[model samples]
Target chain A: MSSFLPDILALFFLFSLIIRRLGVNLAFQPATYQLLTYVLLLTIGLKGGQALTSEFTFSLISNSLIVIALGVVLTLVAMLIIHTFSAMNQSDRVTLAAHYGSVSVGTFAVALSYLQLKGVSYEAALNLYVALLELPSILVGLWWLNRNQSSTSLKTIFGHQSLMLLLIGLVIGGLYGDIAEPMVKQLQPLFAVMLALYLIHMGAVAGSKFGEFGSNQLFLICFAIFMPLLAAAIGLGTALLLGLSIGGTTLLMTLAASASYIAVPAVFEQAQPNANVAQALVASLAVTFSFNVIWGIPLYHHIAGVVA
Target chain B: MTLVFSFLTLLMLLAVTLVAQSTGMVVTNYFMLIAALVVYVGWKSRKSVKVSLLKRGRSAA
Candidate 1:
């Protein structure tokens, strides 16, 4: 996975840029994205479910509780970091905070795939954490959005496809993961291919928006890059506190460094009505997401090597 | 309107069943089948959309 990832990703990213240069129409991209997302998320969830069923323990359950609390705390820290960077409006800060605090499953998937490439075994419960971290930041953001608007609806937060699909994956893994063992063995090679397809689309989407990321002034751009590294530090520290393995520590760091594109926008739109979507998207996708994919993974892996 | 979400629900259930019930090699075999189905449908859908758009442009021109 390690050897092949860089070459294929670079090739795909460069290919996307070439297509953009040639002025080709990519009008079907959003639909393609929906299709890829459906396939990828379901695959991840199903595999995760199977993994979880292999060794379900009380100890793992307790560890998960700690991970959940970590999500809330990280979200607060993300808000604090954003506040420190720029004194944007309260709504904007809270919006950005929630996104930065929440996890990006794609980034997490990249990290896991990277580990798998390296033949490093991470905590399978790591799968559960992506879904677990999805909600708390928004919940925190909602509370931070307004103390008076304190009526938390767990239903609304849980309604997301990302979260629900994962839980379903876990349940499936617990109940019938072993049932599909025969089938899963033959499709193992395609895992990398599926992931590669997803990454190619990632490259195309990010490359198409290449100009938007650069339009920001030097300081804001720097701020966007800096926040994820800081989150990585916090993630690493938290993982150590929990006594997780090197692979698990690296993943936790990636989750910290990653920002949510999927769950956050819908959230802030309703919760903090005055928030700027463009600004948040730029910060999360153009800056943080790019940084993590390009350099953040290696840097986190380095940190794990030293600390873990 | 038969949306993608409806299909997604069924896929997730099937994926869970395959993953949960199977082990190593057999799981991969099943996944290959799933992958073929998704790719074929996605490609076909993409092709049809492009064809329709092209036809619309030609007629308008």
Candidate 2:
């Protein structure tokens, strides 16, 4: 039971939610969340880059291309569903689909922690898959939303703070891996604690959305819940075709299952000013993120184990 | 109306299928717990739902 410490700490989000409901005004500043996000993402990038320094193969390139394709397909399908079923305008639909289609770092961290807790071994290069999977969805969504104008430039998209941080870490770690090893090792022990704090912050944010849910949003709610499951199936099939290990399959599934609450929201707001970002947040952070943290990770692991 | 119902039904079916396919007791239990949470949310959202239904029924009457 002691070994389950990290897994247990994952529920701090629920604790944060309960305390907020009781009128505990802990007014955490925005910078706190921002700093936490930056540290964790950079850590992941460094680790993946370090591994690639030694283990880099042509296969990494191929795997990344496939993952990018997955992100694009997921975004397109989500846009189609929203367009078909909902009354959201073009910008809102594109914004919402981009949120669903991109990957969630928080969810990825939880899944990675789960794999480690279970003593499962996965490819170290899989960390690169996180950054790799983040871009294509947002790019595709931007293009789809602004197909008329030439405003969707590579500069604006790649300039996103989160993406830049990850890429910078990847480059530094890949080029100077020997020098970065000491820093990575120092940061390793603090990972779980940082994640717990981050989840608590996330929980409070998600909790605030609970009261905002209305019956009119039922289709969106259903889509939020169902998208992860559907994407997990796709992730699983891809993992198997690539001959990934069980741990790798589970992480891949989590990547596909997650929706972007951190990176894409700000970018989407900037890219499509007319879109209602709050609506997307309610679905992604409130419904899908909660589902993934509590249930989706374990279910994906179970399915992967059964298949492998 | 039928479209929303169709989607809800499809979601239920998919959730059931995934849970049914799980071989672990713990995983199955998680599914059960999520189902209960879904029901609670549904109950909470019933006010608007009931109001909409009541309006429809009165118009028909």
Candidate 3:
């Protein structure tokens, strides 16, 4: 319990409320989110790439497929659950399913920090996984939303900043040998600070939607809390099958359970405007984001200890 | 955001699969399981999407 940093997640959330209470959108200026998210993605990629100096392999590719598949399975199941629960209408459920199924990079970052504390050596290649995992859910959602229509558009999917920055990091990291340590030293230290900036911006996003929480259907609140646990269960199974070390298992478990508050929303805006964006946004941002940070991280760690 | 989350999921797949193949750490289970999940889920829910669309149609009309 003491290991948890309630203040970090809470602080950004609080900052959001304060700014909202003051009646200003200070964070949106100069597209701070774009810059900050890319930096976070690039640095994470570089650090991760440095970790994987051995360069490409079948296991890395196949495991990534599995992770992506895991995401798809989760998203599809989450959509089913949301619909079955009558959580919201079709539009909202589809959008929300995408959110639930996708991985939260911020949460992953925090989990990585936690793993470092435990002295766990995580796969640097997982950095690429982090970026790549952002896609399948969005594509799944867009496919659902636009199945009736034509042109879901490959450019729309690949053109995203998150995916691109992540690739650049991986490429740079994969190509460079031994220099990763210095790069990691310079970049990784700033992770906490970068995360703070990202969270503050997210807080503003959450803050923007503060009034929108629990307005019509509040069942997603339950979904939000339950998702991490569900993800952990599946992740634990995956970890066991992968034969990952305890720390690796824990990190994988954490990632599996985590929810996306960043990339999925952008896809919704870009491709599926008719889908209920606000419901999905509020549910993920306000509910899962904080839940994972404050309680879910520790909860998943405990689950990992028990299961892994 | 939900879609973007999935997007992240896909990107990670691209990164890891390439590396794992090189390092000889490529586990076939991941490939088999992901394929199975997709195929199974698609089979089970094949009709659900159409049903929902019909429902939406009824509601909309």
Candidate 4:
């Protein structure tokens, strides 16, 4: 898990860049991308379910709650940091904040694979923790951004496609468990193939956009790179103080460190279209996503080894 | 059949880790060197590409 993460991440980062560069018009190829995303989600759900069945103790649930709380708090702190640094307006700040607050599914998937490889077992409830942590911080960030204005509706805020899929995936996975074994068997191979293809496409997209890393993008990219480490440090310290295991500490740190590209971006597009999608997308997809995959996991593992 | 896939995935993951572990410092150095190479290539290519695009636009104008 530890060793393969860097390579897997690097591959994904390159894949995303290549896909972007292909200029194949993602909008027209919605089904392909959508299936790719679903497969990823389904993989996450199944793995999470399996993990949950293994480690569903009272303490695990309690710790998951703690992790969720910490995730939200850390997200707010990251938002505050972004606001302080960038001269972004309130709406843009809120949009960015919501983004940094929510976890990236891609990053989480990589982290999960990393952990599994390293032989580190975490609580299955953490899947729910991952799902639960996505929406609230978004709400909080949006509410904070719009508190001055009275026109925004909650329905409008929560009505995001990625968010809907996440919630539905979680519910279906949790309720069905492995009882959906027939379904799992039917879907697993298809999902696996789709995941690999999506990843390949992602690599192509990211590789093509590698040229877009200009001076302005540099600052945003640097923020994504370093912020995860800083957040992980804070999370690790907090997790230790709260008395979590080594695995728990690592997962918590990961959750804190990850930035959402999926749910947050979709929401921002609808809610705050004025926010720089190009900037956010470049930062999240090109900078942060790549860094987390290649370097961040190893750094976290090294840190966890030192501390734990 | 499902188990076979799972086993294969696990094996692939294991292979990845084993290679990284064996190479360790060499792998890290390789990554850093490759990253530098990619950046340079990307920058050089981008400059020419941007220049060409600008020239084309000016000609049209």
Candidate 5:
């Protein structure tokens, strides 16, 4: 067993207790939630910027594009599975599909950290791919959900807050990356404060949403846990077929395994308010988030080693 | 307070840019700090909001 496994488990238990004792409402304030989102965005942009500073080769770009394509395909498969097994309404299934399709930045971050700790080298430019893979699944998921429903509109679905912020951030990161020096130096401190503020808010959000988990939510929780594993397995297979390194394979697998809390939930709230945000949030944040962070990262790494 | 948050956010952005330009510290300190702060403030706000809601419910009862 990896040395970090025990630490992850301990952290999970500790966070759960703290969240349960404090209550969810106390953990997830609206302002804090907004701040957390911003922080995540900034982190992603910075990572992309740093990665962009390095040399970009054709092979790296090609591999990234392939990984992204595989991500979308795996997301579709996950959505199909959810649709097949669960009793969720069409809209809910679609929303859930979008989430499964999208990448989880937190999960990706954790995986990146894990790989670095393991002394594994990977293409930092993959961060750009992570950002790229986020949006298409959302569009596809929304399209699938609204296919039969008259209530859905292209404008409303495309013009979501999460989508807009993510796109703007990605664009800025890409543009600024080409510049010789950092263009947003003035805003760095503000972004830092916002990022810290955002994570705390996310903790609160996760805590409050914890209450939303009950017997009624068990099926979805189970689905969330298993579906990622299944998707990761497929992603791993695809990576091997593409001859990606173990580190690259693990990163792709992690991306597949992670679900969207930031982008999907935001879009769902605006597009389908009645789709039970608490249920989605609780399942994604409380159950799956904890599982992936505490156990999945190390577990997947071990598995990838055996396979490789 | 909002001003503080805004000011802090600006400082964070600058710090991140400097760090990014310098060494390859994969972990973004500013982001982690921001996340921690947001969670703390969020928890506090949530508590106050819940208290207000509970008090209103009691009065109605």
Candidate 6:
């Protein structure tokens, strides 16, 4: 399993970029991208829910709350840094905060894939942490953005497509338990395949956006790379405090290091229409996502190994 | 309509996975199948890839 897959992933990404450079558009449909992402999200939810069948506990609740709080803290800190360094307006700064604060599912998937490849075992239901960590920063961002006015209803936020699909998959897997074992096992083997496809799309997209790198100011680009490193440090500290294993520590570091490309933009598009969503996407997707996939995941693992 | 299709697809995929499992297909086979599928796609897209390689080579020359 480990022999050729990782090498193929990196090769596919570089190949995508090379293909693009040759003026071959590779015109994959929009729906194909959506379907790929949805499959990945559902698979994560299903696996986490299946694990939760036996592992769910009160301690899980405590850990989830801590993780959620970590999201809030990360967002607020992002808001501070962007406020100080970025000359962008208030809404833009808040939007950047939301992006930085929320976790990236693509990054989380890669981290999981990395652990599996290395035969590292983590806490079984860490996907619960992923789902829990998605929301708080978004809510905080909205609240800060619209402090003077009424914010988007929680119903609207919860109804976002990615979160809903994840929650639905989690509920289904949790409810079915061992009855879903065959399906879960089936889905498990397909994860790396699904993720590789997702990353290829991500790489193609990022490759196309490489031109946009220079359009962003120096501070934004610096923030994009450095923020994840700093966030990983914070994540590592929290994981140690929680007495998590090396795998758990690494995953937490990744969740901290990743910035949202999916949920934040969708929500911000609806709520803060005037906000600079494009800037946030360029930073998160083009800069942070690539960094995490290529380098940050392994680095976080090494740091986690050393520290925790 | 999109949401409905997504849900249906999920269900269908789950059923297929179960059926595949019950048929005694092992996990490694599934992995190999996906690996091959990826390779097939790459093969299909080889024209663009070749063009890109030639462009790079010509530029270097």
Say which candidate scores most in DockQ: 2
Q: What digit string (tens of lDDT, one per residue) describes model 4 on residues B14-58?
A: 343345456443245335633553464456557757998999999
Error of 5 at B35 (Å): 32
Which segments of candidate 1 are over 4 A away from where they belong?
Answer: A1-11, A14-28, A150-155, A210-219, B1-61
Query: Candidate 1 vs. truth: CA RMSD?
Result: 16.3
Runs of candidate 2 with Cα error greater than 4 angstroms are A1-6, A25-27, A214-216, B1-22, B37-61
What's the iRMSD of model 5? 16.9
Clashing pairs in 2: none
Across A34-65, the per-residue lDDT of candidate 4 in tens digits comes to 87787777666765665566556677667666
Task: Chain A only: give the TM-score of model 2.
Answer: 0.93
Candidate 2 local lDDT, A1-308, one digit each (tens): 54222246556876777677776644358998888888888888888788889888798888888888889988988888787777778888888899988999889988888888889988876788888888888898888877888776566677777778888888889999879999999888888888888888888888778777554367666778778888888899889877899999999999998999877888877778788777887889988988888767877887888886
Model 3 CA deviation exceeding 4 Å by range: A1-30, A55-57, B1-61
Ten-residue segment with the worst summed lDDT in candidate 1 chain A? A213-222
Model 5 compared with the native: what TM-score? 0.67
Candidate 1, residue A81: the lDDT equals 58
List ranges where model 5 is wrong by over 4 Å. Answer: A1-19, A22-29, A59-65, A148-203, B1-61
DockQ for the candidate 2 complex?
Answer: 0.29
Clashing pairs in 6: none
Q: What overall lDDT goes with each candidate model?
A: 0.68, 0.79, 0.68, 0.63, 0.63, 0.77
1 against 2, candidate with superior TM-score: 2
- Who is ahead in lDDT, 3 or 6? 6
Tens digits of per-residue lDDT, candidate 5, A191-303, equal 54543344344555566666676543545655666666777788788768667677877887787778888777877787777776666667777656665765566656656
TM per prediction: 0.75, 0.89, 0.75, 0.72, 0.67, 0.79
Q: What is the TM-score of chain A alone in each candidate?
A: 0.88, 0.93, 0.87, 0.81, 0.78, 0.94
**CAPRI tier of model 3:** incorrect
Q: Kindly report the docking quality category of candidate 2.
A: acceptable
